[model samples]
Target: MTKPSLQILAVTLCFALPAGAASLSDPFATEAVTPPRPSPQAAGRSAGVPCAREIPAAPLTAIDAVDLTLCNNPQTREIWAAARYQAAQVGVAQAAWLPNLDGRLGSSRLWSEQRNYNSTSAALTLSWLVFDSGARSASGESARQLLAAAVATQDATVQSLFLSALQSFYTAQAARAAVASTTEAERAAREGFSAAESRYEVGIATPADRLLAQTALSQATLNRIRVEGEARNALGALASVMGFRAGQPIELAAPPAGQPDAAFAQDVAALIAEAEARRPDLKAAEAQVRAAEAGVDLARAQGRPTITVSAAPTWAEVDRVSANGGVVGVTVNLPLFTGFDTTYRVRAAEAQVDLRAAQRDSLRNQVALDVWRAYQSLTTATQSLRTTLDLVASAEQSERVALGRYKAGVGNVLDLLTAQSALAAARLQRIQAALDWYVFRATLAQAVGALDYSLLEPAAQGRP
Candidate 1:
């Protein structure tokens, strides 16, 4: 009889337990399985479209590249997302100024001394913070400043992306020019080799001359191969920056023919001043400083008094006897102590303000340095461009004379080869100098916070 009674008591206790109580069979329960979804490419195919297909094969220009990058690049999208998230934070801060309402319902059963009783209750409450020593106002201001910073950050990202696309586009163009130059050199080498062979067969040129010409041809061929590879690599880089897969086919328009912008020739000090005034990063830093200052104010305000008003309306039932009641009250809460937590928080916020100010100063110094460096680089490239143009003309004239004399048996193969090599080198230098000038111009624009897709357009059209 005792064993039966104990068993019955255990069974009663198990049934009385709440639904949320742990069960012995929990670890043995079968896990829920989720069905796998199709991959993105497969899903696209199912939707009657393909992923990673080539875009319309238009002649891509620097401006087109910039547009593509801004549209497709993940960095730009990521920054935009961040800006949206910060905007949401601003909304959250604003919500604190509004009233809050809550509703709750509860049921209970009590058993004592073999007697049972049941009760049910429901409540609807409203709370409105009438005052908090300007804490809400400071918080809202801080959120607004943060949102401004995020917008500035997005602007800075756009400029940086434009500069990157510009570099890749110009690099691809330079590589293409290099391939053309090498092809010209190879043609000249082939002509020289043919002349040497014909002269040797006629007993006018020695075997050494033929060998020298052959060696020149080989060198030119090798240079062409190397430059062709470089051209391919540069194209791949351009495609990547334009937010396409590497090795995507893209035909680029010829770069515009123009000197560096007159703006780049301005005084470095003036450039620095412009950068300080216009740089998006600097603006973002200033906004951060403002936000940090607001944070300090918010922290200090936390130690002050808060005033709130609340109302509650409730319904209750016990053993089928029901009653309705309501409450309305006003309260004041003064934070007299919190183990010095508020004091520490205020100090930390003040330190953060100082840190942001320091960062802004540091960024200003960096901007000045960037302007100085870009100014020097642009000047050097401009000078080199003029010198290389002269050098190419002189080398070409010398090569023609040497080739003519060799064909007439008056000049040696060595002199002809020498002139050919000089012309090739001069051509390559001219191409590199032109590219450098363009790249440095973009760099200077970026340093002055003037880099934009409009700036990449043809200078003859108008400067942005």
Candidate 2:
């Protein structure tokens, strides 16, 4: 009787089990436990990517394409070329310390009586700055400073060009992403339209629903077309920046993968410090200050004595005749005070020094402000990228659920369409967020006035 009662109880428990319970002969339970879906990316992709890098891009190397474009740009090249010329001027100023030699050759014929003489003269005049106080020395120093400033200006030009190139590269890549995004949206919309038509045929969905889906499909298709066109334009712009013809293929070289992360928290201050240390423009201003000091010295030296020596020798020769004569002399002009010319020049030089010093201080403040702003931008972009990535993941999961529901006839056409639209928006947002982080990183580099050559590709090297 006890065994029979236990068997009846076991049978009763088995019969009372819910149909969908995990333990009750459920085949789909294992399938439902499958892993989470992947994030919307070119299979095996990750978040906050510095930029989508291709193998073709790796060959560009940091030095080749970028360096050459900045250095070799016909318009930009002039800045460096002019810098060379300014440096040469330093040599000219140094020349004052050396003697000058002039050679002359001439023949003169006279028609007057005994006093008139036919003559030919050949001579060299030599003059050296024996002393003009410190004017020569001051001028030489000023010229050297000017050359340094010019070189700094050239550096700034190169930096500016590289920043522009980076902008173009990122812009084109963004457009590329946009085209892909829009194309997928169009495909999703068409699928939605098809789904809507099938539902309407079964008398479940309204005709208006099918029409709405079709309209969305048309709009998505148009948007894709526009985005594709924009991609072409962006590519052209990138090519042009590379010193290539518009419409040329701008092979984007992958920069070393950088991500906007909390790593910036501690490093942002350091970046600001780098801007001060590495920025060439600051050095240029400092050079001007030194140049101004030299100018002051130059002015103060005005009344000082400057000794110059000159000599000329002459002779008369007849082509077929006999008599000849010659004369030789040395001349020197000592500085004579002319209404205190030196004193006024000294005053002017003092004024210039004050003005230039003020300008240098102002520039320093401006640079500091720029550094601060760039740091903030980098931080903000980094945060935004993280948020967008999370959103994409959520949207992807939602999209999968919707797909499953619609196929099972439990979800309506509207649910499927909305889910698809949301997924597209999420994907695009993520793409844009990734691009923003990269662009802000480039901006941060530019603000600091220094660039890591290692991060650049080979295609960017060699401006000369």
Error of 2 at 100 (Å): 1.7
TM-score of each candidate structure, all chains considered together: 0.84, 0.76
lDDT of each: 0.80, 0.66
Q: Pick the candidate with the highest TM-score.
A: 1
Q: What TM-score should be assigned to candidate 2?
A: 0.76
Per-residue CA lDDT of candidate 1, range 368-405, in tens? 99989988988888789778878999999999999999
Compose the digit string of candidate 2's lDDT tens values, residues 36-56: 221112112223233222223
Determine the backbone clash count of candidate 2. Answer: 24
| Deviation (Å) of 97 in candidate 2 | 1.4
Candidate 1 segments exceeding 4 Å error: 1-54, 109-118, 257-264, 459-464
